[model samples]
Target chain A: MKTQHEVEQFLYRQAELLDSKQWQAWIDLFTDDGVYWMPPEPSHRTWEGMPAIFAEDKNLMRVRMGRVLHPDAWSQRPLWGTNHVVSNVVIVKSSTNEVQVRSRFHMMELRRDDVRHYAGAYTHRLKKTRGGYRIKLQRVDMTNAQAAYDYVLQVWV
Target chain B: MLQERIPDFSKFVEPDRVRKEVYTDAGVFEREMERIHETLWIYCGHESQVPKAGDYYAVQLGRQPMLMVRGPEGKVHVLYNRCPHRGNMMCGDRHGNTGEFFRCSYHAWTFHHDGRLRNIPMMESGYQGTRYGRDNPECSMKRAARVESYRGFVFASLAKDGPTLKEFLGASLVAFDDMCDRAPEGEVEIVPNCFRIIQHSNWKIFLENQLDALHPSVTHQSTGRAAHEVEKMIEKKTGKAPLSYHMLSAFATVTIDKWDNFQTINHPQGHCILTGYMGLRPKDPDTLKYEKTLIKAYGQKRMEEILGVNIHHVLIYPGLSVQSPLQQLRAVRPLGVDRTLTEIWHFRLKGAPEAIYRRSLAYYNLVNSPATVVNADDLENFWKCHQGLSSDGGDWVSFARHFGRDIEKDGVVESGPGMGTSEAPMRNQMKAWARYMGNGK
Candidate 1:
């Protein structure tokens, strides 16, 4: 069993990759069949039958990365940046090859002249492999999921 | 507050160009609420949303806070959200069951689901000599001047008199018809919640973009190209790619000039329809099953006729934009001159296969979700447009593309041959806006 400190280290490294705009490296933290879901509400348990903010597999994530990194993507022209503070790490359950971890995150995103704060609870089902932990599923429950946002959320929360 | 001089709308709104004030001025937005959104028949909500008795969905039509609630006897009523006494709002939450009757959180005044007064606390002692009583209409929650539902989709008009809901919808009624008819059960129900986005742009900018047919290639090129690249790579490796990838890639594959092949019928009522270009009828197993279900419901010939209704989008004048083919619609509620609230709602076809619903869900998430790059770029442009319009760099916003080339027949304007990118829709909308503004006091 991996220690709680070791799991925290893995999460911090993942957050570092995302903050540096290393999308591919951040995506590599996920297992091959991993899913990232951002449902509109916390009550939305599944993405199959209802609407979701994002419910992308690795393939779609790669596609999204491609768009965000593209030169002509106007929304990225001014190039937003995010600083993620991941704390309150708790290992809820663990098994030989898998563990479920929960954490609270506050991401302050800067785009153009505005700074938006997104705080959320992240529940990650991590798959333990020879190398390290890989995310099987990451569910983001945004605190302001129902807010009438000023504009589109271009990047992942 | 009254303006010293009423600005002439005729000068601001011309045939092919409208003054920037039309979009940037708060005064114009106020006039729009009075003359356009409040006066016209605005879409309230589908009957399916408030299916159970006492179930209420709060909706904002123009500036009025209203409620669309299902009464005990299965009638859906659109009433003012305010209480008749003391002007307190009846329902505070977005939507919920008010139980047997609506009991005001303040002062414990109760009313039936139909907005009729049931009883007021200490009615005999408190209101014995007052005009407030069950016999007086003022004692009850005020109802909208007109409420009508067509094929399960309800709409309400605040003004006492005007064109009926059917007349207002006109050719645009096909939006609902196309959506409901596609289902084997001939109905579509609203999926529980919606994505509410507040854009920092005028409401008209969003409406104009609905049938513009010219911005997809320019604005979404980067996102589309990226999806196309991934789709091709997947196709090369697996010999096939999912249809969801095609939904994004189509923006890149369908070049700018090819958009000219699709036509827009710009109605005088400001309603517009863009000819279908997505070619949604793929012969996959899921689609085939859905087709079989539809055939069993309606005869094969009728099913084909229903499926072959060439429509990509329908812009319902000043407030609603419907993509019936995909079973989604966006209701535009202008919050202010530069702030607009849009409710994006998707529906499930009653008798279609679950996989078919998934297809529409894919489009809803990929193309319309706030996180999607397609919508992100569009929103960026909308914000930029509003910012620029508020500046003094330009006075008029041009709608001059193919200006004189549109053919008008019996008040319906159609783009000239091979002129699908014409600005006829924007022109038609502004013409209607001018008429509505001119008619108002």
Candidate 2:
């Protein structure tokens, strides 16, 4: 079993990878069957038949990263920059090979001529392996999930 | 006395182009709200949204705040959100049940679910000699002039005198029929909640893009190319990739010139239907099971006829855009001259298999959701278009692509052969707009 300090270190490193736009490394933090979910509503428990802001598997994540990183993505023309502050980490439950974690994040994204703030809580289910801990599922509940955005969100929160 | 200068609205629209003022002018936007949005039948929420009695959903119809409430007998009524007592708006929340009756929090005035006056606080003591009484209809909340539903999708018109909803819908009624008919139970139910987006552009831009077959290739090329690359890699590795990848890659696979294979039928009422191009009928196990279920519900030939109705997108005049094949729709509500609000809602085929619903969910998340690259790029273009139009860069927005080549038969305009990229839909919409704005009907 990993200690609380080790879990905090893992989360901080994950945030660093995201802020630096390390697409592949950020994705590698997840297992092969990992799911990245941003539910449209906090009451949404599953992504099977309900509409979600994002319910991507590994393949879909790769597609999203490729599009955002592409040359002709006009939405990313001014080049988006995000700073992430992940804190309040709490290890809800830990077993021999699995751990459930809860935390809060505030991401400020700068695009073109506007800055948008996204504050959310995350619940991560991590499975321990030889290399390190890999995410099995990451559920994001955004505070402003129902806000009428000025434009479409191009990147993950 | 200062004479008001009457603007000639007809001069702003020609047979092949429209003046930019039509999109940018505040006065023109006000006129559009008065003559087009308020006068026409605008789509309200689906009937399934307020399935139980006393349940209500708040919606905006043009500049008026409205509510769709299920009455005592499961009938849906559209009412103005204002209370008759002091004009204090009732139901400040987005949606909730009013319990037994709608009681105004300001003065304790109550109204029935159908907008009828139910009771007033201390009627005998407070207003014994006053004109206000239970018999006065003005004491209750006002209602929309007309409320109608087509196969469970409700629509309301503020104008009492005009074509009925069916007459106005005309050929576009197929949008609703095609959606509900595909279900095994011959109906669809709302998947509650929606993704509401506010685009910083005129509402017309969104309706025009619904059938503008030319921009998908140019605007979304990056997304398509990226998805295609990953799809090819996945296929090489796993021998076959999932169908979800093709949902995006098709944006690239179908090049600009290839878009000509699809066509649009532009109705006189400003509605348009784009022909289907997506290959939704793969012979996979899940699909085969769906087909079997459909065949069992609607006989073999009937099921074939139902599924064979090929449609990709349908624009219902001033407000709704329905993607019937995928059971999703986007309702446009104009918030201001330069602001438009869109509610993206999806539905479930009532009795279809779970896998079928999952497919619909996948398409909703991948294509319609605000997070997807497809929607992001489209929004960027919308913003750019609005900014350019608002500037003094140019005066006329051209719709001259194959203008005179369109074939008009029995008032229905269709693109000429091999002219699928024709701007006939926009022209038709402008012509309808000119009529609506000129006559004020």
Off by over 4 Å in 2: B1-4, B439-441
| Candidate 2 backbone collisions, by pair | none
For residue B316, model 1's alpha carbon misses the true position, in angstroms, by: 0.3
Give per-residue lDDT, candidate 2, residue B301.
100
iRMSD of prediction 1: 1.1
- For all predictions, the C-alpha RMSD in Å is 1.4, 1.6
Q: Candidate 2 on A18-88: residue-level lDDT in tens?
A: 88989899999999999999998898889877788888888888888989888888887876798999999
Model 1 agreement with the true structure over B1-441: per-residue lDDT tens digits: 255466889889889999999999887888899888898999999999999999999999999999999998999999999988889999999999999999988888899988999999999999998898889989899999999999998999999999998999999999999999999999999988778888889999999888788999988888889899999989999999989899898888999998998899988788999885567899989889999999999989989998899999899988899999899999999999999999989999999999989989998998877786688888889999999999999899999999999999999999888889999999999998888888444
- Highest TM-score against the true fold, candidate: 1
Task: Quote each prediction's TM-score.
Answer: 0.98, 0.97
Worst 10 residues of 2 chain B by lDDT: B1-10
